[model samples]
Structures are given as C-alpha cells and as structure tokens.
Target: MSLSRNILLWMSENRWMKERIPKFGFVKKAVKKFMPGETEAAALDAAYQFSLAGIPSVFTKLGENITQISEAYAVRDHYLRLIDKVANRKLDIEISLKLTQLGFDLSEEETFKNFTAIVSKAKEKLGNTVFIDMESSAYTQRTIDFYKRVKKEHDNAGICLQAYLLRTDQDILDLVEFNPAIRIVKGAYKEPGDIVFKRKILVDDNFFLCARDLMKNRSNKNVRAVFATHDEKLIKRIREETERNGIQKSKYEFQMLYGIKTSLQKQIAKEGYRFRVLIAYGESWYPWYMRRLAERPANIWFVLKNLF
Candidate 1:
C-alpha cells in the first residue's frame, strides 16, 4: 500500500481520530470533497448533479449494522422520505440498501420486514430499481434469502455479490435462477482468508469470471451486471471480453465509488458504456470512508494536504 493510504487506514483504526477529526470545521470541509455532507439532502443533491451530467447514480445512505429494531425502522423512514422527495421531482435514480442497516444483528425477521418495507415504498413511489447491498460474509446467506423473498414480490429489486468470496461463483449461478440484477464488487471489508481470496489478482480474476458467466447466460438477460471497480486494466479487459463474447454494452454497466476516478467514469461513459456512481451519504461515513481510502491510498495524502 502507498504511504498515504497506510496513514488513512491507521487513522481509521484510531478511534480518537475518527471521533475528533469531524469536530474540526476544516476537517469536515476537507472531507467534503469526498463525503458530500452528513445529510440526505446533501446526498440527493450530489446524485441529482450526476444525473444532470449524464452519470446515473445509486444513492446509499451511509450507515451499517443496526443493533436496534427502532434504528432499522428509522432508517427505513429516511429512505421513504427520500423516495417521496425524488418521486415528486420525477427523478431517475435508484437506491442501494445495506441489510445490516435493517437490524440484521438484532433480528432476522425484523431485518426482513424493514428491507421489504423500503423496497415496497420505493417501488410504489418511483417504480425505480431497489438494490440490496451485500455486507460481510456472515450475512451472505441471510441477505440472499431475504432478497429471494423480496424479489418474489417485487421484480424490480436486486442484490450485490462480492467477487472475493469463495462461494461467489456458485452464488451467482444459483441467484441467477431468480433473474435479479447483480452488482459485482471486489468487496470493501477486511474479511477472513477462509471466506475471501486474499490477493488482488485472484479477486480481480474472480470478478471477471463471474461477470462473464452472468453476461453469457441466456436466461440471465435480465441480469444487468454492475462492474464496480476503478482498475483501468480490468475495465479494458471487460470491454474487450464483452465485445469478444458478443455481450452488448447495454446489458451491463460500470460502477465506481463517488469522489474517486471521475475521469475514468467520464471516459467509460464517453466510450459508449453505461456508468453509475455509487454515491454514499450520512453521518456514519468513517468506516466507509476508511475503506475508500484503503482502496486508493493516495486519498490519504489528499485529505492530509487539505487539512494543512
């Protein structure tokens, strides 16, 4: 890892740093280049701006692992409000939800109800897509099951898959039987080697292989693939492999995290590929922000330079 990235990860682990840095007005200002703000409005506005610029987005409210049913219910309400606001404007946007935010740790039943409520409301409001994000490996089976139940009722729903996981290929094959849109990410969390492949090359290879399977399968034509990564080589390989395999550009899209690789986002879009920005918003950005820093490493220096 780069020196700057190392510093950021170190900072992420430093509880004092995560807690105190936001207190400094300048620190918040510096981080705004990436975080946008600590509110739903801030996230919506940023996503709207991207939409205007021809870059579609998936708005993810920044929080995770709710330990209380009340907290999950409240998070569901926040999404309901967001849906209402966007529907009034007739905006074209989708929502990405994390199951952990639905009190998965507290009660599986409660989590299912909370997630289903959000999807039902979203579908009612805008008739747009609702994507359930995959959390850590522990919740993988539950998430898949929850998605299965929800998708049975709402065809517009989808879920994410982590390519780094050992079971991802089989998971994709099995889930494709449901015909849901799948976002393939290299994963963000630091998981155990038993559950996830450790090397970047292995992870990238898994990502492409899974992507290829999803693209080539005939029954999975409805299986819109989201290639969520910033690696240029992987992007090129995707482009070449997709063309070589006769998978039309419209069948899949490239996804990137917001505040990183804007140029690549534009470049891919300009080159005739669909691009979607994963725009995150909320007060609970420390962990997510740390993961982003770990991914780019250079962002650590960027944030530090801004502080100075």
Candidate 2:
C-alpha cells in the first residue's frame, strides 16, 4: 500500500484517533459522503430509493466488540426488528452484521445464540440470506468456525472472506463442501505483512483467484457467491472468466458499497448481472470511515473539501 493509505489505516486502528476524530465537524461532513446517516432509518430510506431502480441492498448497523452481554442482546433485538422492518416495507433488502457486535468476545455460545435468532427471524420473515461480516485477522479462525456451525442449521447464511489474507485461498477450498455463500472482498484491516498481502497488486491477484474458484462451482445450485469490490479491472477479469467458464450471469452476484460507484453499480445491473449494495449505519463509524479512506487515499480530497 502507499504511505498515505498506510497512515490512514494506522489511524483507523488508533484508539486516540477513534476517540477524537469523529468529534471534528469537517470529518463528520466527509463521512456523510459514504454513509447516508448514523441511523438505520436513513439507511433504509436510501435503500428504498435504490429498490425503485431494481437494485437490492444489504443493511448493516455498524458497531463491534461490545463490552456488555446486555448490549449484545440489544443489538440482536435491533436486527430482529430491522428484519421486520424490511418485511413490512416489502423492500429488496437483506441483513449483514459483525459477529463481535453480537458478543463474540463475551461468549461464543451466547454469540451463536444471538446470531441464530437473528438469522431465524430473517429466514422466517424475508426468506433471505443473513451475512456474517468478517473482522480482523485475530478473529478470522473463530469467525470461520462459527460460520461453519451456523450453516449446519441455516442454509440462508453467508460469510465474508478477505482475499488479502494468505490463508483465504485454502479457507475457500475448505468450505467448498458446504457449498457456501461466500462474499469475497479485498480486506480493509491494517494487518501485518506476514499474514496478509501488503501490496495492492498481490491482493488484487488473490481476489481474482478467489473469484474464479467460487465461479467455477457455478453448477452447484447451493453455491451463492458475491464479489464485493470496486476494482473495475478485477471486475472485468472476473466477468471474462465467468463467460469463458459458461457460467450464467445469475449464477453469481457483484456487491459494492453504497455511494462509492453508483454508475458502475447501475451498469452492472443494467448489463444483466446480479448486484447488491451494502449500506451501513450506526454510531460506531469512526474506525469504519477511516478504513474507507484507507482503501483509496484519493478520497482524502473529499475530506479536505469538507473544511470549508
């Protein structure tokens, strides 16, 4: 990564920055360019608009690593209500969330309980997939293990995997048996060079490899794969591979973040490719916002523009 990106990613992990940066008015203004607002209502309204254009959305309330078990239960109940909200609105929306937000740190058993309840409600109400958002390297194995356990009971469950990690190639292979619903993205965490691909080209290459592996299993009806990225070159490469493999356009999906590439997302959908946009909301956005800037240092200009 470039030095600017490296610094921004470092800032994303710094507790001091996390505590103070969100206090800046200009920073908050810049954050609005990514997230519509900190409330789920704002997120849902934006998604409802997208649905009018025939675009489906994934909703996630951002906050992770909660300190209390009661807080986790509240988070769980929040999603249960969110699912009901979607069903009531008849919107093309699904739910994605961090396991840590549901108390992965407090108790794995309780976390599983919380996750299953949310997934069960989604299954009963919307009949859609409930995605488990992957976190840092520290929780990688445990998250994968938890996802495996969840799959035993819920088929409408999916997991995100980071292509930047060296182990992801094998990780994808191991889950092939589950005919897993995997959303592969170039990771956003500031991980060490030993475990992750530090260079952009290497990460991009790994992402393509992961995409190809998932698309290769298109013949399986249960293999629901999503490529969650904004890299146009990599997206084209995946498209070419998909065509060459004779995989139908509906066999896999492409997901991008809200407000990042609106035109490209529309183009992807217009061209008959399945697409979804992830819209995140909630108070715990400082770290998430920093990581968004870290992904593309060029976005610093947007932050700077907010100074006026």
| Best-matching candidate per lDDT | 2
Encode model 1's per-residue lDDT on 50-83: one tens digit a residue. 8787887788888887667899999989888888
What is the Cα-based lDDT of residue 181 in candidate 2? 90
Best by TM-score: 2
| lDDT score at residue 237, model 1, on the 0-100 scale | 91
What lDDT does the true structure give each of the candidates? 0.81, 0.92
Runs in model 2 lying further than 4 Å from the true structure: none
Candidate 2 per-residue C-alpha lDDT over 157-180 given as tens digits, one digit per residue, 9 for 90 to 100: 999999999999899888878868
Candidate 2 has its poorest 10 consecutive residues by lDDT at: 213-222
TM-score of each: 0.91, 0.98
